[model samples]
Target: MKKLILISGTMGAGKSTVSSELKNILPCNVFLDGDWCWDMQPFTVTEETKEMVHDNIAHILNNFIKCSEYENIIFCWVMHEQSIIDEVLSRLDTSGTSVKVFSLIVNEKALTDRLFEDVKKGIRTEDIIKRSIERIPLYQNLDTIKIDASNISAKEAAQLIKDKLK
Candidate 1:
């Protein structure tokens, strides 16, 4: 059976970086970032757009899951709530696929430091720091495997996740 690895965390939690690294380590694997579904100009956040993006993600992921060329499908997103996870999963045809959910947890200090660097580099805005930091505690309530990423590099985090798959 194939594996569907769902990685979630707050912004700046290294979900993209770790997912990329995991892709490099895994053979016949494909990685999808949920943000790609919402990469639009004006970046609207209305209910319709949210529903559309979720549908887009599910559509792409289902294709990947059904493809014979890929054995592992890795998806990462800022799934801050269980409802979001459930919504995405509910749309997927996961038969014959082992689904694993992971949340990358980080301490406030670490999260702040990371986001601040992104701000410094202009990768993210200043307002994002506070909003992202505020969501740190939210991951604690999620019913998924939590990986404390305060001090680990993306490679290490990916390794830890890969080890857990065994």
Candidate 2:
């Protein structure tokens, strides 16, 4: 069975950085970037988009995994809220696929700085810091392990994940 590793965190908390590093560290593991599932959807900040956002998370992720090349998959996204988290877990559980979750977190200031850089680089489609911060406090509670990412390089972060997986 293909093991599904979901590395989730708040925005700018190094999810992509660590995901890439971890992908390199793991032998024969292929990464599926959670962001690619965006499907060119318009970025939105309205509360009205909540259902759409959650549906995107579950639908896009599940669909990608269904046809992806890798049997063992590692994916990263800024996933908050237990309901959304449960969607993945429930599917993994029901399907008998092994699953692991990790949360990467950092100081609020570091997060803000990263978000700013992402915005400046035109990578963070939604550049609203307030919305980003509003969701940070909950990431730690949704995962099996929470890694303090403020002081760690992506390489070190990846090593830690590899160690834990072993």
Candidate 3:
């Protein structure tokens, strides 16, 4: 049977890292990172842009769900709100697929440290780090399994999800 794994988390909580590791560990898996769909030049996070990105993600995921080429479709994104999760779930066709949702969580200290390292690596800026940290609370009370990523490596977190799939 096929499976759809939706992984959500804060910016520095290792969603992308875990997704990559999960893809490596799982067979016939298709990995989709929502950020890839929104490679906008300006990169503004307006309401309209959010809707467009979500629509694009949903459409692509819908196609993945319909395809039989992959046994597992892994999607990672910052689904900070329940409504976004609902919207994505509503867009998918799960006739013969098992769906699993997981959220990676980290404490503020760990998050700040990670984002700080990212900033030092020149991949991210201070403004982005502050903004991401500010939005950490948005993941609260989300309707998904929460995995503590504060001290775990990406491979370890991927193994946890892998164990769950079995």
Deviation from native of the Cα of residue 24 in model 3, angstroms: 0.5
TM-score for each candidate, following the candidate numbering: 0.99, 0.77, 0.94
Q: Give me the runs in candidate 2 sitting further than 4 Å from their true place.
A: 44-71, 93-96
Model 3 residue 68 CA deviation (Å) reads 1.1
Evaluate all candidate structures by whole-model CA lDDT and list the values in order.
0.95, 0.73, 0.90
Per-residue alpha-carbon lDDT of model 1 for 69-110, expressed as tens digits?
A: 999999999999999999999999999999999999999999
**Which residue pairs overlap in candidate 3's backbone?**
none
Query: Per-residue lDDT of 1-166 in model 2, one digit per residue for the tens?
Result: 5667788888788888888998887866767666665545575656566556556656655654575465657878767877766765565422645677888877788888888888889987655677877877887677468888888898998889878775
Per-candidate RMSD, Å: 0.6, 3.4, 1.3
| Tens-digit per-residue lDDT, 1-166, candidate 3 | 9999999998888999999999999999899999898888988999999889888998998889888799999999888888988988887788899989999988899999999999999998888777788877777789888888889999999999988887
Q: Comparing candidate 1 with candidate 3, which one achieves the higher lDDT?
A: 1
Question: Model 3, residue 84: what's the lDDT?
Answer: 83
Q: Candidate 2, 143: how far from true, in Å? A: 4.0
Question: How many clashing pairs does model 1 include?
Answer: 0
TM-score order of candidates, best first?
1, 3, 2
